[model samples]
Target: MVTAARLGPEERARAWQDLGARELDVLVVGGGVTGAGVALDAATRGLRVAMVEQRDLASGTSSRSSKLFHGGLRYLEQMNFVLVREALKERELMLTRLAPHLVKPVKFLYPLKHRIWERPYVTAGLTLYDRMGGARSVPGHRQLTRTMARRIVPALKKDALTGALLYYDAQADDARHTMMVARTAASYGAAVLTSAKVEELLRAGERVVGARVTDVETGESHEVSARVVINCTGVWTDDVQEMAGGRGRFRVRASKGVHIVVPRDRINAEAGMILRTEKSVLFVIPWGTHWIIGTTDTDWDLDKAHPAASREDIDYILDHVNEVLSTPLTHDDIEGVYAGLRPLLAGESEASSQLSREHAVARPQPGLISIAGGKYTTYRVMAADAVDAAKEDLGPGVVDSVTENVPLVGAEGYQALANQVERLAREHGVPAWRVQHLLDRYGSLLTEVLHVAEGDSSLLQPVPGAEEYLRAELVYAVSHEGALHLDDLLARRTRISIESPDRGIVAARDTAELVAPVLGWDADRISDEVAAYEARVAAERESQSEGDDLTANAERLAAPDIRARAVGRALD
Candidate 1:
């Protein structure tokens, strides 16, 4: 059996030692979906590759997306057919062949406001949407009368829509998927290290060669060499290019997108809704037990590590979504708000929403390759292109990328495990829904996660405040999923930070104590982690109440990063 790789503390220490042992074929700098994809692609193509990140995996924009895998429907309306077709093909691959256990189909209703030519116009666009890239894994679009639409969506006002067009798209937990990609790369013999910061680029005459990396936890530095260094750092592209001693071929701009989470019962709908906004579009995406309504697209120049969502941003989404809902939601209904920056390739467009989502790859120097500007759904294509561009530096004998045929770690026997959910739950003495939840999160690796609690069966019980997650999952995150801090376990590994009503404050101390022994945290360290996380949650709450971006950014800066605090490193 091809077993999945475990990225525990011991493996991380070995990766650091191996990083300085010899020259590598590829050194990828970033831990987002694109960077993880690059490592997996290079490793599967038989290249000696290593990926390093300053923080935990998916700690940046990769985790803060709208969580959809659709071929941007708005792009189709913009007449960018090529991008839509390519994205649709990737979406199909993820749903059917690549990560079926992670990605699943979801239905959305495009509510029409006009009684005239709107229906036929939308019908024509959706017909083309259905046929693009042979999207047959999910059902096609269906036209519905107003009554039929109301049958599924009773939350709509009586006169909100003249009719509706329901279509299918796919969604996944972006953070988990990105982490799995990194883990799968490690399984294929790629050295994956987190909390490692790149301080400088190594130069051999006029060409870039490698980098000087810092271990954020222990304040240790290492000089690592590689034949080619690929910069997959989105939104921070120019900073890395400057480190390379010259400006690259392209520039990246940060576009801020904000999303809010409310209880699922707040909007009584059987299916999600898509409404056209004046600037762009609003998606009422259905999360597990919550409805995610977002997002406002505007230019951001303040903070990149932590983007702040202001009162204005929240109000924009609430007002737009309320225009069609029977019950207008207020601030009291909101449970969570998050902001992310999209690294758009700088262009002449005055509005950030108008920028293209197509990715570009360039070899700025003889040994440096940079990839920027793309949607989350098409990361594999972007990674393949970046590695293909590196062939010039690698000389010959480098084979083509074969990641399209490689399934992520947990995807391999998922269907068979899913079929035995009832039996597994009965044997384990847990509820069937708990088994299904584990299956959705871990797929065929459900047994591996459960195995973390071998001696103590109580680890299978639900967490105290956040009942959706199991205590065993927290231990598994620390032991297998590379969760190094309290923030990583709550925010990325399980998503308790944004899913809970109190933003995971109630579960903070208990969770920290639970993972303290695994992380080798003394009592003082446990107190520091808990205090840092609480301060972070408080900062986010205060930032959301501010009226403008500048004030909100100031408010969010109150919380210091736990990993950065050890070394007293300044925020980039």
Candidate 2:
């Protein structure tokens, strides 16, 4: 059996010591999905690998997403056939081989506006969509009349569509999925550490060697050596390149996208809905107990880390979706609002929408590889190519990439375990629905979460403010998922920060306590962390209630980042 991996203080020390003792074959500079995938790909290929992130895993764009894994239907309009097929193939890989624990199939309805000439045109496209790389891991697409479409989506106005086409695509909790990818890499002998910032590149006469890494938690800096360094920082790709003192092949620009989550009752949709908008595609995705409606695409010049969504943006979505709805959803119906930036390849065109989603990997120098421009679905292929680029640096007889056949940690017996969920739930004394939820989220590794609840029934109770899930999840986030702060737990680990009306405020104290034992934080520390999370929630709330962008941004900026505070204190 493969040894279970954990990144403790002792292991962290060993990781650094190995850097000086021997040069690492591959060093990844991001903790997002792409970086995690790179680490796993390199490690599986029998090469020494290490990954460092400046913040918590997936703290940036990776965490905030529309959370769908689809063959880019809009790409068909542009005739970007190759990109769509490539992404579909990778999506199939994720649903089947790579991260079955994290990714699953979701069905969406495409409503048609035209009465004539639309069905055949849309049907042909969907038929091609079903055949083109998507059929490998998902069910076939179905054609439905307007009545049938309305039956599944009652909130949609009857006259809004002439007919519909339903198709399946993959969806995931993006943040958890990214962390699992990182953890899976660690399980396969890759050294993964979060909150380790790369201050500068360690270079020897113009060739990249390694990095100077700082432990944000301890304020300790260490010199580490590597043979090949791959920059996997998404929106911050340019920053990493500058640190390595190399000119990148391409520049990255930030495009802000926003999503709003409301209770499922508000939408009354049996399946998700996808519609064409004047600017971009609008989706009402079906999340568990909630509906996720999103996404406005506009260039962002403000904060890249936490892109604030203006009240105007909210009204934009509300107005558009309300136009197609029988009963409109007002501000009161919104439970959560989040905005994330897409790391798009920059272009001279005025529209960010015209920019390409295709990722590019280039080795500007002999020992440095920088990968940018790819979408989430193609991360594994990107990682594989990245490792392949370091073949010379890893020395003679470097093994070929074997990640295509390697299953992610929770994937081995997932289907079988899913079939036995009812029996497992009966044995565990929990409801079948709860068991299904666990199996879906954890796959075959649901036992890891259940172990905590078995000893103490109290841990099984739903959290106070959220009440959507278990308290054991909070404990697991710290013990296994690398949750560093209260915000990490509430925002990314469980998404209670965005799912609830109060944004996990009432549950903050309990979540802090749950992580205290695992993190070894003192009482004062826990209180401070909880307070900080509450302030963040408050800031976001205030931001949404404002009338315009300027006031909203000011309100959102009022919240303090825990790492920024530590940085400020260190400077003082």
Candidate 3:
């Protein structure tokens, strides 16, 4: 029986010490889906692994994705059968075997405008999609006429569609999923540390050996030795490769993708909708009590850390989505907005959307390996391939990846516990819906979270401002989920930053105070955390109102990072 891999403050200190004390078989950079997957893959394969992230896990593109786990329907249209099949297989694995708690099946309606030819054409595609990788986890597509389609989505314009095709795909909280992957890696004896930035690559002659990492929280630096370093830094791949004194074999181009959140009532839809745009597809995905509609594929050369969604980007999404909706949505209806950069493999096409979603792995140097360009659905395959590239350095004894068979930390017995939701609710003295909510987020590991509320039943009450989350959840994040900062808790752990209308402002001070004791935060530190979070929210709000990427990026960067500020003050 595998126990829950707790990633509390104690574990973080031990991880830092362990990374410096031993020579690791593999060192993974980046804490996105691919990076975390690589860490789990390497650790489960019986290889010693350590992963370091510059900030909280999934602080980059991983958290800001469209949050789908489907085999790209557009990929099938592009005749990229191999990529689609591989992705569908991974989707099946996630929904059925790997992360049943995190990944759940979601229904989507594809509106058909052309009455005569479109239905048959789409039917053929959906048939292939259902059969691809033996996708039996989700049901096959159902055709619906305009009358029926409008019933399912009353917000649809009468002329918007003649009919629709309903199909199934999987979705997950990308940030939570990535963090769980990191914790699962730690459970398997992998040293995973966040807020540890790689300042430089340690070199021995021509071969890359290790890295000098600086703790972002403290100014302390450590030289961690590893036999092979796998670079999964996503968009920052080129920058990291340059530090190794090599230009690298491939180039990565950043494609900006932005998503806006609106209340579910504004959409008036029973199911999510997927609309075809001239450039690409637009997904109005269901996200809790809100709808997430987005994604513009445009080249971006600005700041990678905080990719801002400008007014034009927001207008583009609203204009396109409004074309199909009966009741047009305005900027006032938007509750939250976020922007992320996709690391596409650069090609001669000049169009970021045309660039390949297929990933590539290369040993740029004897000891350095880099993997990039894959979509979120196929992160597991990317991880496996990345580790395969590092095989020569890992020696003959390292076995093949067993990650396909290995469920993540909270995955085990999830179904059984889910069946017992009513009973669990009775035991916890919370509403059945609340118990189900906890079960979905934490799976069988819900027991561990409830343990935090053992003596104090008030901990099970809803958070002050973010009522969707229990106070116990916030405590659990700081104590066992490696949330080192206020941003980590609100932004990644619970997503209150993006879900709330005020962007977690009302909850910042209360949340900081809740975890103050666990994190050893003094009064000054607690105040700083709340102030920094407020500044971040303000900057993000200001950026969204800006006209262009340049202005938005500048505004977004105005917020001082609390960790950076603390380090500077300490030195002063």
Model 2 per-residue lDDT at 295: 92
lDDT of 1 at 320: 97
Clashes of 1: 0
Q: Tell me each candidate's TM-score.
A: 0.99, 0.95, 0.99
**Model 3 agreement with the true structure over 1-572: per-residue lDDT tens digits:** 47777888888888887778889889999999999999999999988999999988999999999999989999888899999999999999999899999999999999999979999999999999998853497779999999999999999999999999999998999999999998899888888899889999999998989999988777788998999999999999999999999789999999999999998999999999999999999999999899999889999999898888899899999999999999999988998898999999998478888889999999989899999999999999999999999998877887898999989988999999989988989988999999988988998899999999999988999998899999999999999999989999999999898888999999999999999999999899899899999999999999999999899999999997776775675576
> Per-residue lDDT for 1-572 in model 1, tens only?
45899999989999998899899999999999999999999999999999999998999999999999989889988899999999999999998888998998999999998999999999999999999953599889999999999888999997999999999999999999999999999999899999999999999998889999999988888999999999999999899999999999999999999999999999999899999998999999999899999888999999889999999999999999999999999999998898999999998498999998999999999899999999999999999999999999999998999989999988999999989999999988889999999988888998998988889988998888899999999999998999999999999998888889999998888899998888898898899899999999999999999999999999998887888796753332
lDDT of 2 at 266: 93
Better of 1 and 2 by TM-score: 1
What RMSD does each model have against the real structure? 1.7, 2.0, 1.0
Compare candidates 1 and 2 on lDDT and give the better one: 1
Backbone clashes, each candidate: 0, 3, 0
- Weakest 10 consecutive residues of candidate 2 by summed lDDT: 1-10
- lDDT of model 2 at position 125: 79
- Compute the lDDT of residue 538 as modeled in candidate 1: 96
lDDT of 2 by residue, 155-270 (tens): 88988998899988999998888887887899988888877889999899888989888877767787778889999998888988887776688899888888999998998788
Q: Deviation in angstroms for 166 in model 1?
A: 0.6
Best lDDT among the predictions, by candidate number: 1
